[model samples]
Target: MQTVVTAERLWDGTSLHQHPLILIEDGKIDSIATHDSAPIPARAQVHDFPGATLGPAFFDVHIHGAAGHDFMEATPQALDTIGTFLASHGTSAYLATTVTASLDATLRALDGLANEMAKLPQPGRARPLGIHLEGPFLSHEKRGVQPAEHLLAPSIATFDRLLEAAHGHVRLMTLAPELPGAVELAAHATSRGVRVSVGHSNATAAETRAAIAAGAVSATHTFNAMRPLDHREPGILGTVLTTDTLFSELICDGIHTEPEIVRLWWRAKGSERAILVTDAMAAAGMPDGEYQLGGFPVQVKDGRATARGVLAGSVLTLDRALANFVRFTGATIDQGLRLLSTNPAAMTGLAHRAGTLAPGKSANLVAIDAAGNLVGSIVGGIQAS
Candidate 1:
């Protein structure tokens, strides 16, 4: 059976088409055209949104979990709950992010998550693309809520062990650039096809530059968990903002970053290098209360998630992040959409799997209003319920 989706306008990650009509067959996009360019097929099922802008569904490369379930659970039930919640909020795929924990526990979770990633994506659910290792190699001075005891020095041998446990499914890793051997680890991780992102550090400008030179492609959560920028010494935060080649992740929830700083980050990274991520935890989509981020207990109140007086992840969804970013930056909706979809996908090297609407691609997309609010989401040609 064929499905036809029509909207007032469409931004296919690269270009906008007015009166856009998309045809899907067997869950893949068959063709895209304007209403004036082609007639709708008589036998196809049609879904129309009169005043919505259709675009590629979001891809969250730095999410932990949602719907009161942590990705560290690494269970089928946990993934199903998280994925279903994510899809409803316009996310089509995400990286299963892991926080620092015991070496044995981390390996066990990785093994389980890799097995889950191997399964076919469920209809109307966001799928896990790969693993994002956000811990074990971090600066204790800037670890935030990441448990201190579990933090490890950068080590190729340890990374290799984790990668093997993940069955080579580790696509991204966050490391503190100031740690000894971190530059070498960055190079080695890049050699193994893993993208390195510098964060959780108090590194000086020169150390941050060394990491970038050694293949650190991005920065994690820009301002948070990073050395503050200074006029004389600068630091990792300064290098991240000034480096045009490096991608930077920002959690746009008003709690994680002030609006003024969000605006600053937007001006610095612009549309090309700026990426929006939820950095969401299990408390996302759930009522405020106590929640778990990895093995640590976090207190949630009024949209803030904290552990030991430090911000721990967030409860913001990508859709909300989109709206907040647009409100803060005054950027066009197309630019905001690209920050959540195109930039993150490109930064994580998963552009082929997501970030665009094209022929032979999965029929994953979302409908948003002029204000960048999510109106509806579709995954695998099925409308999210």
Candidate 2:
């Protein structure tokens, strides 16, 4: 069946087109016709958003949990619940991210996620593209919510074990590149098709450069769990901010990174290299209360999530992140969409089918009101609101 969705404005990942008519067929976009170019077919279904902006649906490559569900639970119910909640907020897909934990526990989580990812995504739910292993190989001094006892030193054998347990579903891994054997581990992970991101480390600038030389392409949640920048030595944070090729992930919830720092980082990385992520825990989309993140107790009060008096994760959604980013950076909606949609799609290796609202791409899109608020979403050509 063919369907036509029309909106007052359309952001095709580059610029906004006025009064665009998008044609979707068989879960992929067939074509895009402007108001002056063609007429809508009388027989086909038409969805008209009179005063809304339509664009590519958001993709979060680094999110943990939402709606009273944590991915570390490793259950189908948790996966489905989170996915459903994400779709309602205009998220088309996300990575099921993991945290630092015992080797056995982490393996169990990976096995469960691998099985879940193999199945088809239910209607009205976000697609779980892959897994992001955020810890177990990290700096002990910088471990935020990760238990110190479970932190492991960088080793090829352990990484191989994790790769096997995930059934090759691990798309990204975050490690402290300053640790022993980290450069070699980065090379090995890259050789096996896994992207290495530098984070949760106290690595020096020179050490960070060496990791980048070994195929580290991104920085995880910049400045939160890593070494601070210094003009004299310019630690990991300095290297990440200065490097042109390395992508930086920012948690724009206004709690993780300050609004001013967010603006600075945005200026540094721009739309092409900066990515937005919700390092959210189970408290996201739920009322403020107690929650669990990676088997540790956390307190959520007034939208802030913390553990042992330390900022643990977050309670942010990508839609809110987009709004905050626009407010902070004073960027156009078209440029902001690149951070949430284009960069993440490329980072996750889904650029062929996802990201842009173009012919032959998957019909995944989000609808925002004229005031820049999310109103609805379409996932895999199905309305999800």
Candidate 3:
């Protein structure tokens, strides 16, 4: 079956087309043309959004879970629930992120997640493109809600074991650069095709720079679990802001970062280097209450998710993040869309999988109003329910 999607304008992760009509066939994009130039095929199903701009669906590189199901569960049901909820909020793909846990527990969860990734993707649901290992090598002082007991110094052997369990599906790993063997681990993980992100740390600026030289390409949830910037020492936060080559993730939920800080971050990272991630937990898209984040219990009240007086994760969806970012930074909607889609995809080396709408690509995209509000989402050529 052929489907035609039309919107006021289309941003194909690069340039904009006016009055665009996209042709999707067999879950792949067949062509993109202006409505006046290319007539809609007779009998083709048309999905028209009168006042919305169409862009690539968001790619969230750091998210715990949603709809009351933690990604650490690594169950089909859990993924289905989470993925469905994510798709409705304009995310077409994500990396299932894991928190710090015991070696045995982490390995088991990795195996299960690998198995799930091997299965076929369901229609109308966001795809779990890969795994993001966010734990095991972290600083206890800045670990946030990650379990302290399970935190380990960077070890190549342990990382290899986790990678094997994941069956090479680990796309990203977060490490504390100040750890003894972190630089070596970062190099090793990069060799094995895992993009390294520096975070959950209390590292000096020099240490952060060394990690970046060793292959750390991004920073995880900047400012939340990092050393404060000092005028003399600068520290990880300063390095993350100053380094133009490094990509940085920000949880733009206003709660984690103030509007002023968000504006500052935008000014530092700019449109090319900034990536927006939810870092969302099971409480996302659910009523405020208790929810699980890895092995810990988090309380959600008025959109805040906390554990033991420390911020655990977030209940933010990417769509809301887009709106918040625009509201906070006053960036154009195109810039906000790039932060969520293009930057994350480029950071994780998954640009071919998500973050663009082009011929021969999967028909994954979203329709949004000028204010960055999600009007609709389509994944694999199926409209999100």
Per-candidate TM vs. native? 0.98, 0.97, 0.99
Q: Which runs of model 3 end up more than 4 angstroms from their true locations?
A: none
Candidate number with the higher lDDT (2 or 3)? 3
**Which residues of candidate 1, in runs, are more than 4 Å off?**
none
Cα deviation of 193, candidate 2, in Å: 0.5
**CA RMSD (A), model 1:** 0.9
How many clashing pairs does model 1 include? 0
By TM-score: ranked, best first: 3, 1, 2
* Model 3 Cα lDDT, one tens digit per residue, 1-385: 9999999999899988899999999988999999899999998999998888899999999999999999899999999989899989999899999999899999999999999999998878998889999999999989999988999999999999999999999999999999999999999999999999999999999999999999999999999999999999999999999999999999999999999999999999999999999999999999989999997899999999999999989999999999999999888878889999999999989888888999999999999888889998999899994
In candidate 2, stretches whose alpha carbon ends up further than 4 angstroms from where it belongs are none
Model 3 residue 240 CA deviation in Å: 0.3
Evaluated at residue 330, the lDDT of candidate 3 is 86
lDDT for position 71 in model 3: 87
Among residues 3 or more apart in sequence or in different chains, the pairs in candidate 1 whose N, CA or C atoms overlap within 3 Å are: none
What lDDT would candidate 1 get against the real structure?
Answer: 0.94
